[model samples]
Target: MTASHGNEIMVVSGASTGIGAATARELAARGFHVLAGVRRERDGDAIRGDGVEPVILDLTRPEHVRALADRIASDPRHRPLRALVNNAAISVNAPAEVLPLDEWRRLFDVNLFGHIAITQALLPFLHRSHGRIVNISSVGGKIAMATYGAYAGAKFALEAVSDSLRRELAPHGVQVVVVEPGAVRSEMAGRGAATANDLAAMMNPEQRRRYGGLIEAVVAHSLAFTRNGLPSARAGAVIADAATVRRPRTRYTVGRDAALLTRLARFLPDRVLDRIAAANLRPYLPRQGT
Candidate 1:
């Protein structure tokens, strides 16, 4: 939208808050016309600014996806798409069995399939410009902790999809990169804690008796993890680097935790990782009942 900006466009989903909003701003500052996708009018208004346009986007909705495609295709300047940052996600922490099937589907809708939909819709522009796809993954993708079945599962699936998509597009010059971020200070941490508590409350008495303490530990640990985690702007800068670098790596880790944990997951045996996870959560677990 500015004369100083280049004739290229970038799309960042979930631009309402957290890393999404930060990444949108980062891309805009770097001189790309960034289309920041938010789910609400106020969010769009909040994020819209010079060199950054806001699109009302809900990836799970085909109409929203189509509209975004149309918007890009109809750009008056015909700015070719330069990158698409798939960043929309929701976290639900509960035992695999405790989380109902519908909840799992809901998570997958946004985390996995929704990204697929967006990628499929915009692949043409990417192919045209030989642009890249930056998937916002998580440390959870590499290691699955207790009460992380749904969230970790979705991220793992996204990681796999990214690999396959990268291979599939490499011959055509399109790049696909995955950015795995450790805990970040954001509203997501609070929402994850609230969601875990809500699901725990809905469990049957026997279910609660079986997993109540563990759920509480996870909630407390997640809050602490987020409290001391990386800043959104820092994480966004890493993502922006991944998106714009001349020769980008296939994958990047936003924080030291993500880098170390992902490496540990690769070499350590499952039993070892299990022990490590338990050790990390032990301090948060509740003591003997009153």
Candidate 2:
């Protein structure tokens, strides 16, 4: 760790990779002792350098969340937890018509409910320290896309929850901010691609003849763009800034693309945006064949 204020400490969930890992590294570099929460021990070990204490915290597990809360609450440093960054989330893409209910539920289990569990668990510590909470929502949270129904649904729900939490926590001297990243160079893209592939495989031959190829193609193209998007370090900087700012706003849209896309989505009419998306995704349609 570099050197932070003696009283500053931070916790970041989903610290295994991508934006979460970058945020942990950046915070540690700033001299804050960071509790980097990860689901797997190997991931924890991998990110253990630079004063980051890797903690096994799967947000889906209430026991782990409670343990984390207990540790923070009992810390002698007495230094308030400077921030709690909820960055652990899963993105799934499937045809809404045929998407499995279990898949939808799983998305919410990690992306929405997990965040809530961790937040509720850590509330008392935050109350004591007057710390900040940063939820890593997405641009999808604002606008729903065709094949990403499940992921979009969870993100939208999370946005509402975060907004309400911000208002409710404000009076208690705790700051809550929602970060909506558009696309970032992260593993999430590959995972989304896998989900798309799985969905394509599940379609019947006639269904594949109709829409399966198109779905895969669109998801692949989107993933390509996402894989080449902004670096995670950039988003990490925004998260770090949100943590230390004396008066942080309720939302931070990280990266140039994220900022631009959000502006376009907001200013453009719903129909216009829909048409634009449709045009871009049209090329994936299958040609007549056996």
Candidate 3:
């Protein structure tokens, strides 16, 4: 279905890369006036295009979210935002047993709380336009992995919040939908692998001996899956569809592995799943230090 907006404006957070960047492109191609909200000016400049407007939007800053809301609320040309895509997120891989509290907070700050803040600030403008909210969650939200403790926790929280918001906004003619993707190809995946490698390197001798192997395995497995995963652009199209469909679904599960992973997660017992995950991730453990 075609997007409901005819020259309507869309604000997309985390548009610098991955699904956000691709979504921005897709929306612009579809005739929506797109605002590509990014944290860095360089990232923004790299993304500016024929129909895309790049804006500095760091989700962690309350003022940024508020200012953006105000802009949409007051702009005579585009007072009401037609859609808001809460796609900004950070992925940190570490076992919960060793994961730092600050790491968890940092993950939630951008992934869960930040999105909530931006959404709340923009609700008035969205309400005026009868707009939609598209949340870019992950397969981790629905399924627990071996080493993505904090990232998965944030995504899981986002899923819960999105569900509540969807129910609350339905009466106002607003739609909220969740997009869960599995192993999409993106630079973020590579960064996550690299981060894991660094973390493993930083561990003390005992710590490294106790958990380093498992951590490295997680990183390696992630790199392998990402190398073989669906393209980020494919996932972006699903997100764009979520934003514009007349009767958008409550959730859209994309990528070849999404269905399989979600089904396995749902049916397999927790202990059984854990065993499977351990086995799958074990092979990637860093080989003995060179």
Q: Against the true structure, what is each candidate's TM-score?
A: 0.98, 0.93, 0.94
Per-residue alpha-carbon lDDT of candidate 1 for residues 1-290, written as tens digits (9 for 90 to 100): 23234789999999999999999999888899999999999999998998889999999999999999999999999999999999999999999879999999999999999999999999999999999999999999999999999999999999999999999999999999999999788899899999999999999999988999999999999999999998999999999989898789999998899999999999999999999999999999999968
Q: Which pairs clash in the backbone of model 3?
A: 217-284, 217-285
1-290, model 2: which lDDT tens digit per residue? 12466566799999999999999998888888899998888998899996688999988888899889888877787766778899999878877877788888888999999999988888887888788899998888887778878888898899999989988998998888989987789888887788788888898888777767668667767876787788999888888887777777788997776787778888999999899777767776556577
Expressed as tens digits, the lDDT of each residue in 1-290 for candidate 3 is 36545468888999999889999999888888888899899998899997788888989998888778777766677535789999988778987767778878988999999999999888877888799999999999988787787888899899999999999999998889999989888888887777777777777788877887788678778889888988878988899999888898898998868878888888988998889887887677666766
Off by over 4 Å in 3: 1-6, 286-290
List the lowest-lDDT window of 10 residues for candidate 1: 1-10
Ranking, TM-score, top scorer first: 1, 3, 2
lDDT of 1 at 27: 88
Off by over 4 Å in 1: 1-5
| Deviating ranges (above 4 Å) for candidate 2 | 1-3, 283-290
Clashes of each: 0, 2, 2
lDDT of 2 at 153: 89
Better model by lDDT, 2 or 3? 3
TM-score of 1: 0.98
- Deviation from native of the Cα of residue 203 in model 1, angstroms: 0.9
Question: What's the lDDT of the predicted structure labeled candidate 1?
Answer: 0.94
